[model samples]
Every structure is written in C-alpha cells, then in structure tokens.
Target: MMFKKIGLFVVIVIVVLIGVMTFNTFTNTADDPIFEVVEMPAIDTNAVAARLSEAVRIKTISTDVGDPPASAEFDQLHLLITSAFPLVHENLKRDVVGDHSLLYSWEGSDTSLPPALLMGHMDVVPVEPGTEGDWEEDAFSGAIKDGKIWGRGTLDDKLSVFAILEAAELQLAAGFKPKRTLYFAFGHDEEIGGENGAGKIADLLEERGVKLAFTLDEGMVIVQGMMPGVEEPIAFIALAEKGYLTLKLTATTEGGHSSIPPKTTAIGKIARAITRLEENRFPAALNSPASDMFDTLAPHMGLPLKAIISNRWLLDPLLVSELGKGGATNAMVRTTTAITITESGTKDNVLPSTATATVNFRLLPDTSIDDVVDHVTKVVDDPDIKISVKQGNEPSRISSKSGEGYQLIEKTIRETLPDVLVSPGLMLAGSDSKHYETIAENSYRFLPMRFGPDDLSRVHGTNERIYIDSYVEIIQFYRRLLENTGG
Candidate 1:
C-alpha cells in the first residue's frame, strides 16, 4: 500500500511538471519589431519586365575555361546595363573596378554617414552541357510566357541586379537624394570564384577606407514550406554565413593489371576514405543562428512542434534528430560533407596509379578550418591517403539582429510583405558578400521574393525561371529597402 501511494505521488509530480512546461511554451513570445507600414509606390511594370527580360538574354556566363576577358559576352552585358539604366550611369559615378565588375557610387547629401552597399553578381553558372535540353525554355532565351520569365540567372542573382538598377533609376528620376551614400557592386565572375570581380571591388573599397554601414548580398529568399507547421512565408535573412573549404584527398599506389591487384588499389583507398568521411561526419550542434531562428519561429508554430522547440533544453536530442532528416535543416546545425568530384581509373582492365577526390565542407560558424581538418584526418585514419588543403576560409562573424541595419531590413519586409515571418539564419552557399566582412560592420544576405520547394530546386538546376508577379514583388521590396535605408 505504501509503494502504491509513492507511485501516485510520482505520477502527480510528472503531470505537474508537464503542465508547467506547457504553460510556458504557450505563453513564450519573442519581441517583434514594430514598424509603420509603408506601401509600395506605383511604377511601370512593363518597363521593368522588359529590361529584366533583355538583361537575361545577355549570355554573361562565368566559366572555369579562362580568365577575363572571360568572353565578349561580359563586355556586351556591361554595355547593355549602361544603356539600360542611363540615369544610373549619369547620376552614380561608375568605375570598372575589376576585369568586368562594375561599381557605381551614389554620393549622399551627408558624407559623414557610412555608406550602404548593395551587391549582386551579373554572372550565371553554365547549364550542364547536355541538360540544356531539359529547360522549359532556352536557358538564355529569357522567354516570357505563361506569366513567368524563363532563364538561367533569372532567380539566382540577375533579378537583383536588374531590380536594384530599376529602383535606383526610378528613385533617380523622381529627383530623390539620399542621406547615406549608396554603392552598387556588380561582379561579373561570381560563378567561377569572384576573385577578379567582387574580390577586387572589395579591395578597392577597403583601400579607400570607405567603411560601410552594411552590405546586402544575394542569399536566403523569402520562401514558404521551409518550416514545418507554419503556413506563412518565412523570410530568412542570413545573420551569419558558413565557411567554405575544399580538400583534396589523393591516394597513390603501384599501377598494374587489374588481374594482379594488391590488397587495395589507389582508387579503392580514395573511395574508402570518402566513405569514412561521409559516415563519420563532423559533430552536430544547434549553433547560435539556427537557435535564434527557432526562437523566432517557435511562437508561430503549432502544438507539438511549438512545444518541442520551446522545451529544447529537455527535448534537444529528439529535436536534433528530427532536424537532421532534411537537407536544408541539417545544414543549419552541422558542418556538411559532400564529395563533389572523383577521378581515377585509366581503363577497365588497368589500375590507375593515382586517385583523387575533392571534398567540400560548409562549416558552421565557430567551427574552424583546423577543427575540420583534424576531424577529417582522425576519421579517415589512412596513412596512404594524402590530405591537401585546396582552399579554405573561416566563417564570417555573426551580425547582431538587434542593430539598426537588421531592424531596417525587418521593417522593410513587414511593410512590403505584411504576412511573412522574418527569421535569422546561416547561409549555406557562398556569395560575394563574404568578401566584405571587413568592409562593413554588418553584412546581410537576403533575396526579396517568395520561393517554394519546387522553385528552390530550380536555382542551379533545370527549368530555372521566376514568376512574373514575383519579379515585380522583388522590385518593390528593394524600393522599400532603399527608402528605409535613406534613399
């Protein structure tokens, strides 16, 4: 009887604890910024659409084939932009910084205020050689039909380039002047490496001692279906970006006929190392940006998801496992491993003397290059496989979400996209903004348009295009963003 009474007491305690947790989870609310709603001003939709379509038609492709002059196509695109936005060329001081990168400066009424920099790459990745046939329309055709503009760079970045120019031209035509200086840095070779393009422009700005208030670049878009249980489109503004590192693992062994193979060949060794790295990935942790993202989103989530995120201290393991299932969510909390390229085998019957594999890692902030190298070496544990650091850079510093720059961005989103949820996140892909860590106090990555899962797949894949209505929304977003930032 005494044991039964103890069991009842235990059950009561458990129920009470659960009740308290539930109450706290339901009541917890993150402080959202309050801003006056600003309506998007009227503009010529046809003109904007025509210019973007024409811009997309220019085949300004960045490739690994050679250096600038990358192609006559790049030069043609530059000339076209100058012709397209004559007001921008007339008002803003245009300088050809790198081989083909264009930097336009709109001097402010108050020079004391640090300038604001807006960046976009004019280059697009080459469609896979044979996959051109897979496009709904020709990748370079810039075809506009069925309420969509079909092309390669239509969404990735050219949209920003055209929209930014359109906003600036409209503002310029209105005789609007700014309190803070504005710089538009359009890089021509972002797809290849951005070294000659954005890199050189950043160097020049740094040399001029031009400290910027903030730099905005292409990154996470305002998209729906990214979060579970939230029907509203979430605008993920990247507060921090993951570092990039490419490591080459090479295995060398005696070459001979495949019939007399040793215990392991060079190809076998490299393949095994890759498998080990894939199996034993870097440790996963709910890092700061992702944590902040959840904090901002939990209040908007529904029952079980809301409870899980709210009580993360008690439910972390299960939450992490759930988050790890999806590629997008998994990248937020952990350093990712991808074996991008493999090379080996001279012939079917002959064993190659050397094999090499390239492993790309997008490291979370606070996860250093040394930590990654150490983890990889320990995991592989192969003396024959030589590890070489091909290229690497540490992650950017996390920008504060409480600052004016972030708040202005948020305000703009609220005013333009009234129903969206704005959340801070980590950028998985590299962008030109990475070159400006030292040039600006806070750098942000956001593309102002909503994309679904299907649209997300089209970024670097087949059938790449952007909806006509969405393109107009993007232009309006930039216009509001500029007004909020003193345009």
Candidate 2:
C-alpha cells in the first residue's frame, strides 16, 4: 500500500512538470511577420540632402509675435517650402493660420472619408549665442559632410517637415492620388507653446466640421540600447504623449540676514517641497500603451528575459521595478517631474522675502493636472508654501491599437525596416498631436529614421546631424507610407 501511494504522488508531480514545460514552450514561440512584402519606392538621396540643407538655411525660429509679428524668418520659411517642393505648392491648397501656421490640404479622390493629417513643426529652437563655434560646420549653414546632413532642425523636426513633403512630391510625380484626403500641418511655434500654430490649426479644422483619421507628429525617435531585455532595435511609436504642467512652488516669509535665518527659509521651504515631490513620485502603473509595447517586443526579445516579459502575469512587479531603475525606461512607465527653473534670492547675504521654484511636471495619461497639483501640495504638507499650476495641458488620449490607422502605420514600418520591431509606447514629451487628439480618433508619432545610439544625442545638442543613409531611408519610408495610404 505504501509503495503504491508513493508511485501515485510521483506520477502527479511528473504530469504537472510536463504541463508547465509544454505551456512555456507554446507561449514563447516567435510569431510570424505581421505584414507581407510592401513595395518600397526608389528615393533620391542627393535630392533629399539638397532640400534639407536649403530648409536649414532659412531660419524659421519661432519668436514671440510682438506688434510686428515676430521676425521675417517665418516668411522666409514659407517661401523656401514653395520653392523646394513645387508640386506640393501647385497641388495642395495652403492656408496660413494665426501668425505662421501652414495647413495644406490635398483633396483626395474620395472626400467622403476623413483625411490623414501629417503634422510637423518648421521652427527650430534658438541656437545659444556664442556656441556656434562649437559646430564643425555653421549651425545655420546647412552643411553636408561625411555622408551626413548637419544643422539645427535636422533631427529635432525639419527632417519630418521635409521628409513628408518629399514623399508627397514623389507621389505627385508618380500620379498616385490618395483615396482619402491628406492634410499637412506645419506649426511654427511648437518649440514654445503651439498656441499660435497647431492649436489654431486644430481650431480651424474643427470649425470646418472636418475630422481627422489620424495625425502623425514628431516625438520619440528610434534609438539603439534604449531598453534592456530587447536585443534588436525597437521602434517606439508614440501612441499617447504625456502632458505639460508647470507648477510654481512659492514660499514667503519675513526677510532677514543670511546669518540670522529661520529654521526653514523661503529657499529652504521651496527646496524641501521639490525634494519631497521627487522622493515620493507618482505610482508607476503599466498602462495599456506601455503594456502593448512590452507585449509586442517580448517575442522579439532574446532569452529568459523574453520569457519573463512575455508572461506578465508571472512577474509584473519585477518588470516595473526594473524599468524604474533608468531614466528612459522609467519615463515609459510613470509621470516624471523636474525642477527646471528657480527664481529665488536676490543678494547673497539676504534671505529674500519670497522664493519661487518652477516645477515642470510631465503628467501621465488619465492623470489630471489638478490631481498632480493636489499631490504636490499634499506631499509638501506645508501650509506656508503656496502651490499654483499654470499652463497645464492634459495628456493626449490614447489612440486605437487595432484599427486601420495603426495597421497602416505598422504595415508601413514593417515594410520599410524589416529588421526593426514595431511597438507602441507613450511619449514622455508633448507634441503638436495633442492639439488634434480631441478631433482625431488615432494619432501616432513615428519618424522612420534608423538611428544608432550616439546619433540620438545630436538632437537639440551640439554637432546635430543625420546620416545621409538615414535621411534617404526616411524619404523611402514616407514614400512607402504615401503609396500604401490609398490601398
């Protein structure tokens, strides 16, 4: 009887082990490619380089529209666009909104369906004074060297502006018309707030009773070594972008000498508030977009890490914790806060009567600005500290994961870059797409530039450049996207 009981237990254990192994094997098998062959059009690299350089030469810096309507740079940019892409100017109906926003409408063959809006900003942030010498070539010179295009807006956005127009021009040359209308929106004030550019453009479209199918804007880029557990490069599409909110944490007290100060001075109070907000951050949750990013990339990932990420139910906490370790990965999972600017203390010896610290908060989706402000107040727990939030825009709504819009984008990406895996992730930075979020059901941010690790740093940094090969590839990617639009 004892021997028989032992045999039954052994059988049960062996059966359970087999079942576990079988389930693991089935779940971990790599899936087949999402899309079949997508025809890629021939792109002219030299032409693209020439056009990009021309764009860089005309400085479209967005300045405060004072009485005279900012600088002549905006007008020069407009003229440059018309000269660069004659086909676009001839075919598309262009509308200038507010001060410098350019909205071009290419009426599709079928006007019944809503149009697809390809959005980008033409303005580049001001190059810091006296830093132009740091560049190998002039920042505004639009120099091309070593098979790369060097300039200010090359990566920050002028790439998208030119790339999309190049695609449109190619399509026009091929006599390919989109089934649905295509709208190209170029905002001039995205670097500052888009109040005058994209914001007004969205209002105009809304007034016309025109709704967008999807709007693509400039945001996250494809960078190698961006994430752990993934071997190959991952293309992170910005399905939703975090909102921008500025909170002013101010503390006022009686001014006194620095030598004879209160237990906590005005600066000390503001500093403490910032420190608390940083230490006690918003809780990290693996929301839909982030989860989808992991799920899509998991199969492509290498090794035991793949197995772990693929099976989120088994170890979700571990994955989130690991992601929280790094800045880039942590930005993917949670809202981030940084003390960007502080205005406190006038004289070195005097404890000023008031100290103000500007806290810039990148809010997560579904999280309100009010909630963030309230959280900050609660965390600081100081009745003396006054917290006021200004110029807050809620995070853009998350677009559809399984829809024609996403399918089209995914298919185009798969066709253009077969090696890189396509995944959806939240953009930590805000973009012009936020303006169209209310009008468009789906908005995605993707630029088909295959950038290695170091290449990404050039964005908004010294020695900004884009490889000639990457530039050509982006043109091809846009071409494929345009060709596939009607189909």
Candidate 3:
C-alpha cells in the first residue's frame, strides 16, 4: 500500500514538470517584429557572372608576408578594376593607400553626417601545390561551367570586391547620389593578415579625423542547415569577432641520443604541456551575442530546442556543456584551442636541446589575451616550459544590434533576401574589419553569400566556386544596402 502511494506521487510530479516545460516553451519565445521578409529586384545575371569570372582569372594572390611592391599580376588586376568600373573612377575620388590597397570616396551632399565604409579584399590565397590538380577546372582558369563560377577568389572574397564596384557603378549610372558619404576600402593582403593593407588604410583614415557611421567587412554568410530546426536559411551578421593569440611554448632540457633520452626530454615535456592544455580546456559560457543569437533563433526552432533555448537561464549549464562538445558552434561560445605548428628533434635518432610549439587561440568575447596566456600557464604548470605570445589582440567590442546602424543593415537584408532569418552572432574567423573598429560607430562582419556545408569547404579548399544564383543575390544585397543606408 505504501509503495503504490509513492508511485502515484511520482507520476503526479512528472506530469506537473511536463506541463511547466510545455508552457515555458510555448509562452517564453516572442517573435521579433522588427524583421520582415524582403523581395530583391531582378539583376543582370549573365553580366555579373561574366564579370566575376574575369575577376577570378586575375590571380591577385596575397602571401603570408604580402607582396609589398605588388607583383605584376596585382598591378594588372588594379588596372582591370579601374577600367572595369569606369563610372566609379570617373565620379568617385580614388586614392591608393599602402601602395596596392584601393580606397574610393563617394562624396555626399552632407559632410556633417558620418560616412559608411564598405570593405573587401582584392587578394586571394594561393592554391596548394599538389591540390591544384584536385580542382574540377583549372584553379586559376576561372571556368564558368555547370551554372557555377569556379576559381580561388569566387567565394573567399573577390565576389565582394566586384559586387561593391558593380553596385556603385550601377547606382552612379542611374544618377543616384548618397546623402551620407560612402567609402570603399579594399585591402590588398587580407589573406596573410592585412598589416600592410587594411591596417594602413585605417591609420590613414584616423589621421584624417574621419569618423565613420559604420563599417561592413567580409565574415559570416547566409547559410542553410546552420540551425537544426529552421528550414529557411539563416543570415548571420557578426556583431563581434574573436581575438587572435599565438603563443610560442618552448621547452629546453638536457639533450642526447633518442635511444637513451631522459624521461622528461624537451619534446616530451612540450608534448605533455600541450596535452594538459587540451585536457583542461577553457570553460564555455553563454556570451551576450550568443545569447541574442539563440533568442532570435528560438521562435524558429522545434519544440525540444525551443524549450531549451527559451528557458536558457534555468538550463544554462546543460546548454553550454551540450553545445561545447565541439565544431563551429563550440568555438562561438568558448576560447578555441589549437596547436598549429611544432618543432623538436633535429634528426630521427638525436634529441634536440630545445623544442617549441605554436599554440593558436581564438578568444571568446568575454576572454582577453592575458586571460588566455594565464589559463594556459596554469594548466601546463611547468617552470621549464616558457610561454611567449608572438602576437595577440583582445576581442572586438560587441556592436549594438538595437542601434540605427544595425537596423539599417537588418532592414536592408529583410527587403533583399526573402524568408531568411537574420541573427547577430560572433564571427569565429579574423577579418579586415578588425582594423576599422575604432573608426566606425559599429563594425559588422558579414559577406552576402549563400554557403552550405559543401560550399563552405571550398573557401581556401579545393574546387573553390560560387553558384550563379548566389552571386546574383550578393549583387542584390549590396545594392539594397547602399540604397537603404544613404542614397
């Protein structure tokens, strides 16, 4: 009789919990009314595709150190850009900063209002030596076949450069003038780090005391199958980017022949230190931008995901741990850990006196460079292993999504891309926009390209290409952004 009574009480508690969860899932989520689906105007698909193909064929590759006195190919590409967009050069004031970097000023009627900067990089990463044969078409051939434009820069960013020029040229041809000034800043070496490219441009703008309304650069994209439940594509606009830190860990100890080496040899010690770091990973926390992202996505999610996301505060630990399992989403929430390069023994049989490894980290929004170094040092906890930061920077400030600048971008996106959910999220990758953070009121990192799982692998990977339809959408998005922002 007592056992029956306990079972019945357990059933009642389970029923009450289910009722509460169901209510929270349905009631806690509120739809965002600010965003509405927009229909973009028709474009000249053939002409735009042809131009993109030609742009890809130029081979304006940016190396690690950057070709300061740019190679002949870069010069040729510059000449092509000048001739290709005749209206841009004729009307807009043009200047080349940092030798190869291109900057154009479209003067507005009102100089008092801050200007908007549209940014893109003209350079592309070089194709791997052996992987060139892996491409469906010649990597540099810029082949237009099977309804796609194939080449190196088609997705990793020449599309943006071309789209900006095309949009400006068309608007100029249509006799449209902006109320606020529009600046087009194109860096020459974004792939290798943009130190001599966009960095120099930012310095020049700061010296001129030019305050920008906002800056948009390449980062995230419109992706399908990004979110689990949302069938429509999600347009992810990056509100902040992770900080970059490269720490060089060196371990020096007694060295001898490998056959009779010490138990704690230089290489062995360094390896053990790296292992400890991997085991004691940086803790994952839900940041403001990530929280906002989930909030925006909650309404579109299925019942299970919706319930969990809607009541994040109560289930914060569960959500963070579950999402922190790994991959793209994992990096968004926590400081990423990776060992990029390592060096140790001089020969197969001889142990080296010194060993080193490069530990790369992309810090979360809340984490700083110092925080990363400190955490790594604590985890390794070895006096012999010396930690030195090669290069590091704190994460960018989280741009306000509720501000006028973000709304302008959101409204433009809504009117241009129909049935897509726009969410403000963190950009895991580095971009040229990092340099413009101080100059602009808000710096957004996004590229208007539709990238799927398969298509995303093509960026700096084999068979890099862009679909004709996606290319047309990019052109439409830029035109809408310009028209809505200032024209």
TM-score for each model: 0.94, 0.91, 0.94
lDDT against true structure, model 2: 0.82
lDDT of 1 at 399: 88
Q: List clashing residue pairs in candidate 2.
A: none
Model 3 per-residue lDDT at 250: 99
Ten contiguous residues minimizing lDDT sum, candidate 1: 62-71
> What is the TM-score of candidate 1?
0.94
What lDDT score belongs to each candidate, Candidate 1 first? Answer: 0.87, 0.82, 0.86
Backbone clashes for every candidate come to: 0, 0, 0
> Which pairs of residues have clashing backbones in candidate 1?
none
How far does residue 123 in candidate 3 sit from its true spot (Å)? 0.5
What lDDT score is found at residue 190 in candidate 2? 86
What local lDDT score does residue 91 receive in model 2, on the 0 to 100 scale?
A: 93
What's the true lDDT of residue 332 in model 2? 74
* CA lDDT for candidate 1: 0.87
What does candidate 2's lDDT look like per residue over 1-487, in tens digits?
9999999999999898667744763577556357766656667788889889988887776545443334588788888889889999999999999878899998888888878888889888767778888988888888999998888899878989999899888889889888888889998888777878899999999999898888878876676776676767777787888888998888988898989888988888888888898899988877878888887777777766676676577568988888877687787788788888888888989988888888888887878898898889899999888888766888888888776777787788888788777788888877888888778879998887777777766776678888888888787877887777754
For candidate 2, the per-residue lDDT at 457 reads: 65
